[model samples]
Target: MKIRHLRNATALLTLGEHRLLIDPMLARPGSIPGFKFFGGGRRPNPLVPLPPDTFSWLEEVTGVLVTHPHPDHLDTAGIRWIREHGLPVWTSRLDAPGLGKRGLTVHSLEDGALGMGVERIPVRHGRGLLAWLLGRVSSYYLAHPDEPSVYITSDAVLTEDLLEAVERLQPDVIIAPAGSANFGVGGDILFSVDELVTLVRRAPGGVVLNHLEALDHCPTTREGLRERMKAEGLLEKVLIPADGEELHFARPERARGPAAPGPGATQERERASLASGM
Candidate 1:
């Protein structure tokens, strides 16, 4: 599978026959408002322009994935782009109705919706009242026969449920936001740098970190995250790709373990061991 970081949380996730555009905050530089609501570092979002080759790359997209309806995830520009291309959208069951309300043709992505294995893991946007304002977010674990399984943890704060999902899914790649974003009034709405380190350390396979340097609220730098991960003895398992960079994920070279018994058993057994290890 080829994963291209399009800027912010936006990406083109190419797996098998699908080139799924994930969370498109498509905007011309300086066209949108800034996100830093406190501590005074506000600047127009998407500090850079799309790569010169973006259009050629985007032309391969087969569909879209909307983890949430927030402007940063699925902005007005993103919506218009999808409509112009007439691309199909895969979203959570709850968000689908709302997207449909706005005239977007939607496809609900519940468990097994992909005709391959999949698990929908709902996540909290933040802590306390901040979470309420951030609204509900959905993360997904997709297992495709043609490629390594991947877990896309959309905008979210670290939580027991998320950790549990990570332990269970055992995805070959875990794509999570690593910005540690916060508005002045609230704390981090996504995983803090420390939390991301822990998440990367615990992942069964490779971890790809994104959501950095694109918005004002997310201040965690890739260098800082690397230092922490290296300190934690986990630099090998995690990847921090730059915007417009494309990475290919190959299946792990080692082989072990018997096939998991029955439906969901692979995930269930993995989760069970997580608690035992803790």
Candidate 2:
């Protein structure tokens, strides 16, 4: 599989015959309001612009997978782009109705949607009232038959349940948000640096980190993350791509079998897990 990083939480993922855009935040610089409401450094979002030749990449997008409805994940510009292209927006069942109201072609991203094994893992966007206000967020484990399995841990803080999912799935690649985002008053809505170190150490295969150096509230920089990973001796399996950078992954050297259940278990177990996990 191939992934082309576009911006904060936005990227083009190629799995098998599909080119799916992931969590596209396509707004121009400073278009969105600042998220750091209580912080002194508050400013309009997207301090930087999308990389050149972004349209060229967009032209090939076959679909979209939106993990959540937050502005930074799927902004107005992104919605407009998807509408204009008339592409299918595959997202969690909870987000489908809201996105459909906005005139999108919504589809539930479940098992067999894209000829892949799918599991939607519920995530905590923040703590307490803030988390409740943020609503339900989902992280997905996708296992394509011909490609390496990937776990996209969209916009979440670390949890024991999440770690357990990682252990069970044993994905060949993990795409995680590394911004350590905060509103300057509450606890971080994304993983902290220490949590990231733990995550990298526990990963069974390669890791891809993003959601850095773009928005006003996301304070973790790529350089700082690299330094921390290096110190922890976890840099070897991690890839922190710059804007517009492309990455490729294959099956791991250790011959772990298919990430998902076999044919006999696919139907019942897949349905059971998705229902209970969410």
User: Each candidate's lDDT (Cα)?
Assistant: 0.79, 0.86
Candidate 2: where is the Cα deviation over 4 Å? 253-278
Clashes of 2: 0
* Candidate 1 runs further than 4 Å off: 252-278
Tens-place lDDT digits, model 1, residues 175-230 = 99999988877788999888887788778877889998888888999898889888
Among the numbered candidates, top lDDT falls to 2
Question: How well is each residue in 90-166 modelled by candidate 2, as lDDT tens digits?
Answer: 99998999999999999999877888889999989878888898889999998887778889999998999999988
Tell me the alpha-carbon RMSD of every candidate. Answer: 8.2, 8.5
Candidate whose TM-score is highest: 2
* Residue 234, candidate 2: alpha-carbon lDDT: 88
Error of 1 at 9 (Å): 0.6
